[model samples]
Target chain A: MSLEKQIAISPAGELAAKLNSAQLPVDACYQCKKCSSGCPLTFAMDLLPDQVIRLALLGQEEQVLGAVTPWVCSSCETCTTRCPNGIDIAGVMDWLKEEALRRGYSIPQVQISRFHQSFLETVRLGGGRLSEPLLLGLYSLRSGKTLEKLKSGELKDELLLGWELVRRGRLKPKLPKKLKGAGEIAAFFAKSER
Target chain B: MKVSYYPGCSLEETAIDYAESIAAVAPLLDLELAELEDWNCCGASAAHSINHTLALDLSARNLLIARQAGLDLVVPCALCFNRLKVAEKALPVPQENKGKTQPPVKVWDLLDYLTQPEFLKSLAGKVVRPLAGLKAVCYYGCLAARPPKVTDKEAYENPGNMEALLRALGAEPLDWSYKTDCCGAGLALARPDIIDTLVKRLYDRALAAGAECFVVSCQMCQANLDLPQKRIAKKAGRDYYLPVLYFTELIGLALAHPEVDKWLARHLVDPRPLLKKLGALSAFA
Candidate 1:
């Protein structure tokens, strides 16, 4: 008799599989569904916590990979704590989100993603996180066509907060030093990409 | 003393300065950081609120991993530390998660890690340059001390560890009211509308406390306090500026240990003027 062929999984599927495998002892899942009940953003998810896991167990790569549900998770640990199964749902979700993004799927986090992208981009360029310029730049960029729509007086009001901090002894702006272990951090992210 | 170190995402990307300072000072204190291999996110507030078990599993995995690796984990980010601690407690409790192990590891926040008397003594012994007269507000955002389940390491934990650490380095750690206030962590994403209120509160409080500048352990806290305030100010029609220094930068400054230019000067909102006020320029230079 011919042996059944092994199914080839996409990067996300492979990631899910790796996560499950690495997440061995996940069999402890009691299915109490505390994770589902506790989640703040559960309503926003296309596939709730348990479904994501069930799909992951079934090795349903396409659905898990293509789903934007993973990115919607804010890496909050609400479900993981309540789960009797002892699964790191947040970690798994994060892994899935990272994997989905790696596979070239546009799992847009919308506003949050934009915020993350802008903040991280600023960090990537400057080597350390910056607040004022990052906010100004991101808000400006996000405003796009809306920039003109914002009343000049309102724009001035907003810009003045940062200016006030700068003027007072409160917010002092300076180049925050970068980490010596930056290469290690970069390597970790790079490895995750692979 | 050997401790496991979990430098969360921000420590790698946005809070690099803190990393650089740790690299410089860890050896001086004879404090060894054994970073766990194959660690995952600690599932900060967002993940925990989404799925409690998953969050515990993520942190438990790290703890179990750390237990297996033969060291207690030290997390630099308050959020990561808090999340992991919450998971550690909730996972093993019978009423909480009980009897599960996917990801396993015990986690400690940076302040807790350094507050260990032995470690503090060691760091104090190795201070080549003291902080002298520098005054800084110990800004501990809500993540480090609030939400009892997550930050159970201490009863009524104060953000004074950094201040104490600063004092150990011969710098003055200011007593400030905004130490445990919420810096509106990732809220800048979902609720940009209200972040100004949160950011401004922290800024105003720190200033009112008469701190020369603010120092924080979390990258996100610094970002929220430093970056989003501009927008919040823009919205509030007020100018909000506070030099948010990574605790490590202050450590480097106090100890006269300037290793990385990027680490010393990487705030998106420049901290030079504050440094000048603190009399840290020549030492940094």
Candidate 2:
């Protein structure tokens, strides 16, 4: 029986330093598998939540950034809540996704990334609030899921649901009134970018 | 008691039933809920994923508004509450505003706010119609109770606050697994396959535990569980038309509010038949 764990020597400490600066204790993980065991989306992830942390600790920055696990993370905080070591595992995932985007890495989970962009753009245009219909329209256009839905005949179901929601007053077709501090909110985004 | 209400984005659209019911019951509980003027989104699951500072600033702006209004905050959406609470803690100390201390604004999830002893006593006395025959599983979802250090919940997994409120309204709160389970959160929008899997599991567990319906605190959970059940059922070749309802709507029903039916009608799966069968509909009638 092999009692040794394989080690990879690499200059991946850059990712670790970034995570530390972001206040994530990636080094505190001990592979208890508590996080992986509890993550609802673990089955869909290319690397389990625990494996992502292990990669981060090992300085496997390229692999961690390239993996779809972080994008697939729902940020439900299940792993963070259940971690015995008190690691903010979900927070680490969020950082990984941001790092990937910042570095212009090709995200494997394209639709999820596009959805995030669409969501933020909606908030930005709506003056920090989300308008559901506008968001749905923009997301569909950006993700190209609208064409897919049309092809698969799922568009009908979506349209029906939209009609039902609007009828029930659960959704409004008109644009919402922009908040009074729209300029300040937009300036906040601009300053954060700088 | 008065509090600044932050409905978040969902309440303005998808979770309007929750907004309506909360408004409908506010007078009964003697709680004045003033909408936070010109509030914005809490940055939810997406902002943190894209830019950490963006998420913090979005929530901080709202908190600053509530603080400036001189009122404590009451948030109904669990995701909003979690994000706002995290932002409140993580907002960077502005260099220009150094040495100026702002009073801490108390934020309360609606369930936590209503479960306080004084509020519960008032609620109990105002139950014009108790939910006598209704049976439900209180589904807290993930964000509402998780990372207890942030939310300050006593027990994330087995929190009894929602059940306690259910009991107060004379409904049987069934014990079940998946109370704090993840229902795929924002993934419901981007990845329905994952949501389908998660919601199917929740339905199987809830049905096995004899839950007539699911009572939830988060809008995402209600949307995930309610909107996808039909497709999940078709794919699994099973019948699972379980009603996923906001806990606020259930409280409205228990209070015998005339508009409960209007609220229930917004559900994709018609919950009225089940409510009628359980003798829950007559209260609204």
Which interface RMSD does candidate 2 score?
Answer: 1.1
Docking class of 1: incorrect
Residue B75 in candidate 1 has what lDDT?
82
List candidate 2 stretches off by more than 4 Å: A1-11, B92-103, B283-285
Which candidate should be chosen as best, given DockQ against the real structure? 2
lDDT for residue B25 in candidate 1, whole number 0-100: 67
* lDDT measured at residue A144 in model 1 versus the true structure, 0 to 100: 48
B1-285: candidate 1 lDDT, tens digit per residue:
787888865555456667777777677666799777766555455334433444455566666667668576888887777767766665553232246443444467776677667866776877666666666788776566654445663544354667777877787777865576555566555555546666676777777877666778777787677666456666678766677887667656656665734565656567777666656666555
True contacts kept of each: 0.04, 0.78
lDDT score, candidate 2, position B111: 84
Count clashes in each candidate, considering only residues at least 3 apart in sequence or on different chains: 75, 0
| Candidate 2 TM-score for chain A | 0.92
Please report how far candidate 2 places residue B228 from its true position, in Å: 1.7
Candidate 2 chain B weakest lDDT stretch, 10 residues? B92-101
For every candidate in turn, the CA RMSD to the true structure comes to: 12.5, 2.7
User: B-chain TM-score, every candidate?
Assistant: 0.85, 0.94
